[model samples]
Target chain A: MRIERELMRGAGPVAVLKLLERHEMYGYELIDALSKRSEGVLALGQSTLYPMLYNMEAKGLIESTERAAPSGRERRYYRLTRTGHAQLAQQTEQWVAISRAMLALGILPGPTTTQEALA
Target chain B: MTTTAPQHESPPAPQRLWSDILTTPVGDLLRGRIGARCRPRPRDLIATCGLPAELASLVWEVVRRTRLWSTEKVAVSRELIAHFEDGLAVGTSAAELGVSFGDPAQAAALIRRAKRRNRPLIWKAAKLAENAVAAVLSLALLLYTIQVVRLYSHAPNITRNYVSEWNQDALTVPPAERAWPVYLAAMQATNGYWEHNWHGDELSPGSSSWPDITEFINSNGRALELYRQAAAMPKIGLVLGREPDVDYMVNNAGQPIKNAGAAPDPNPEFISVLLPPLTTFRSVSGMLKVDVYLAAQAGDAQRTQHNLDAVFGIVAHAREVRLMLADLVALTIAGDACRTIGALLRANPQLFDDHQLAQIAHRLAGLGGPEGLRTRFASERATVEDFLQRYFTDDGHGDGLGRPELLARLAVFTSGDPAPTRWTPTIGLNTVLMPAISPFMAGKREMLAKCLDFFGRYEAEAATPLWQRSPTTVDDEFIQFRTSLRNEVRYAPLMILMPSLGRAGLMYEYFAQQRDATTAALALALYHRQHGSWPQSLNELVPQLLPQVPPDRYDGQPLKYCLVDGHPLLYSIGVNRKDDGGRLPSPPPDGTKTPLAELNRQARRWQPAPTAQRGAGAAMEKPLPDGDWLLWPPVE
Candidate 1:
């Protein structure tokens, strides 16, 4: 199931920063990872992903450089800057708190066992 | 349930007119030239990808719609092509890829906005400044257009004819009482020989030009007789009509009539309506002076008295005009008469009998009295009021904005140049600027108040005695006020209209002293003729030779009297207010100068020390001379 457009707009930049925080990624890699990791709920088309990347780059949240891939194709890769790393950390905290509140309100499923909690 | 992602769709065919135009051969050539100039080495990765023609065209359409800076457009093009290539690398069909890409127009707009945000700060600031300048220029143009419309839509309503009102009093005087016709006749009877031949000091019997003087008097007997008859007339009654311009009549005509037949101007501009010229009256005074000197030289006391009376009559006639300039001319004529009388008494002591001397003394004593010494500017105030009405729009409450066209005309008029017969660059420039300047200028009511305030101060200052008046008075105040940059803009019209009256005020005082001193000298001449010797003091002549001793105008003290080399000397303490004990200024170290007027100017302390010199410990470059103003025996 896809999230609503308004929810996606709020979630988009933070998700891109989190992905770029781990390592540098290209546009197709980011889109594929977001789709699989979120069970297709965060799936974005080329049009949406490219514009989001450009906006992040403009805001100094991420930087891009064109380089040769292992397959010998020239691809523009994006990486999180220091500012993006901080932003990702902040957004992660906000999401964890929101999930806790949802769980408390019985809107989200609580952990079923001790193992689940530990995980 | 699963939802399909949005597809990147091209614009409908009917909305693709711009795209169609760009595909034309000429458009293609222009595009090629622009592309070479803007993106000299653009990368085309789509061509290498071997993508289908449809997919390739989609990438180009998306990039073209961005409409960003050339460099930014090229960057967007490269990135989009790279993204598509990566999609195709994953074994995705061209159709599936195209379906998921979304609207090209929306993407182009987003990319363009984002790219602009990333531009260098200098470029952003420059763009902002460019936009701001365009906005301000548009606003200014709009405002200027509105102002021009406002200026042109309204017209000045000149309800009053000031010229007719000014001529009303003169017109009421009966023709029989009018002296102008007789004066004109006197002017016509003269041969113009006296005007051409007479120079300064020529009226003196001892002057080298005495021959010319005798001939002038001998030849113009009828003119002299007419002058005497005109002097006896009850009133000047010179009606200044509309036509035959005053200057033309006075300066050009052989016999300028008192009233030209032209009707009064129905619509007259006050400043443009010339005041009746006093040049003819001034000439009459000059001719009468020559007559006085010659008659006195011939020892004919009766003819001398007649000429003196005519000269005084001309002075009285000039005063009736009520103009400050005319008043000044009248004062000058009176001063000349006084000087001629003093010279006559000194040159020919036996020429006049006791009764004749008493008559001359009385006339000199009553020349201006206390009232004439004060400069009158009532007519000047009226002229300014009239000008304000004609030049400004009437809002029915005595307040209105200046009409730009009339203000421009005034500027041209005051420049002392005749109005341009055709459009010139200067007039064109004035036309353009007048509207812009009109908003900043003072309105009619405010200008009138300022004018009244200035005239009021001037009249007050004129009323004060010279000895009691402050050095930094109306003249200095006006100079400082008018010359300031801000005031010059606010009072632009006033700066053009107001004549300088400070020097004229000083002249009035100077001539008043001359008249008084001449009166005293005439009395002294009478005292000597009776007693066979000069009086020991000016007080000795009181109630017999003089009703009372004339006070010094510079310092309210009685006129200084002393015997110099067995002759009676009379003088006043000059502007420095110091008594040099009836001593004249020493002759120039170089030699004697011929012109007595120049000598008198050099001898008299006409002005006090400058303000800068009056400050504590300020050393003057050359100190002003401390000299007594020698009034008699006429400063020979």
Candidate 2:
């Protein structure tokens, strides 16, 4: 199922920042990782994904550089800035609070709040 | 796990001038509705994948619509195309790949919206500036319409009738009619900046401007021609253009008009008042020097006599105009002219006949009196008083400041708006706004009156002999009054106050000295003619020649005079008002001081040892102090 636009917009930069924190990822690889990690829930289209990355880069949350991957094809790898790490930490706490509020309202289940479920 | 470190990094952006901010590419992009779409590039469509033609075209269209920088465009394009290729590698059909990316148009719109939000800081600033300028211009236009209605709606009959009465009085006299036009025309033609570079090196080895002096003679010819005409006129008055500025359009040419308050439309960004008169004075002075040189060369005695008469007439015109306008700088120009003519006569003493020399002495005696300067000072006060009475009430509330016309005109002037631009109407709107907020309107009439009073008091004080006048006391009061008005906008209406107002007294002082010195020099010339020898003292010429000796205005003492090797030397006590025992300083190497300093007491003032002065090409020594007011005769 496709994610709603407003929900995707709020979580987009935070998700990108979280992925870049572990290791630099090209655009296509990030799309795949986000799909697999979120169980296809946050699978952004190719068009949506590139523009999102651009917005994050412009905000200084992530920076991009082109390099030859191990597959001998050129790919743009994005890495998190110091600002991105701080932003991720802040957004994660807000999202946790939001999930707790939704759970108290019985809108979301308690199982989804766990780290493994989140991953 | 590719390392983040990458090689071949692009160079950092170069520094741009602040002026380049508006002209940059991003400045253009952000100033639109959704910003212009980026141009479609062929490279985006030329991907290696053997994808379906229609799918490739759709993807290309989407990327082209996004207004990203070239590098950003390439990254977006390649990644999207790579996603498609990955789908195909997973055996996904063309339709499935298209569905995965969503509708092409929707994707393009999302990217565009994102681009707008992520603009560079400079681009954002430029957009803000553009919007601000647009808002200001719109508000200015609205205010401008209100101002125009305010100015034209009210028929200020009191001011109009007052101006008409003054105009009628102006119609009765032809003030300096003959000389005024010629002087203006000559001024327009020959006048230029008196900067040092304009004249070049006066003592250059083979300078051509000296001998022919064609430019000098031609300009003088115009002034002299005008002078002769004015001298021949039956009568001449001191009145010129007057107040409200409309009289110039209504009155006949050559008629004198009463000067009134500031006009609604003054000559916008006009040349300074000091420039026209000072430049004209310099032109006339330069002519006097050149005429004397030419007369000396041709041995044209008649021409020299005409030149002397022309100098007197032109200088008289200058004095009258300057006094009428209360222009202090013109007084200095008058002094400069007198000195130049004096030097000319002293250098070519033989050029004048005995009778002509006596007449010169007589003329000098007549012009030396300070009656004209005093009269002009009083006249300026009366004019300002009239303006205050007619335009303002007893409590200082009247139309001159309260009117929209003056306010608008002043705004135009202060805004530095080009006089002919669309902003002219808007500039006037400032007057409407100013009265509401500006502290100047409270007692603006009194402030103007005070400004005029300062000029009047200082000018009258200037006439007092240097010994009796306390310059520091006068200056202290002036400084105190000015400091009280500091940063106050009300006094801005007194914009007619020239920079030369305070310093004009010095010019008057110099004029007095020049007059006294010229009189003494002429008297000496006459005595020499009668006795065939220099007088023993100025007293020798007292009863028969001079009536009485002229005293230096500096210290109210008899002007210092001496006969050095049979050449007459004369000077005042100068600004310092000290007698340096008739001493003169030596000439500077650059020849700024005329070589005339080498003659008279200057010879002994410096390098007292006469024997040490003798050498093989010793070169001109630096000049000594000439007791400040040195105008000794050249060896000639």
- Top lDDT hit: 1
Off-target runs (Cα >4 Å) in candidate 1 are A1-11, A28-59, A87-119, B1-58, B91-103, B193-199, B241-260, B368-370, B421-432, B543-548, B586-596, B603-605, B608-622
**Which pairs clash (backbone N, Cα, C closer than 3 Å) in model 2?**
B242-B258, B242-B259, B243-B260, B408-B428, B585-B624, B586-B623, B586-B624
DockQ of each: 0.57, 0.33
Summed over model 1, clashes come to 2
lDDT of 1 by residue, B400-461 (tens): 76775555566576666656544423645765776677778888889999999998888877
Model 2 chain B is weakest, by summed lDDT over 10 consecutive residues, at B3-12
Candidate 1's docking class is: medium
Output the lDDT of residue B124, model 2. 81
Off by over 4 Å in 2: A1-119, B1-208, B215-227, B230-285, B319-334, B368-408, B411-432, B473-476, B484-487, B495-500, B585-626, B634-636
Which lDDT values do the candidates have, in the order given? 0.74, 0.56
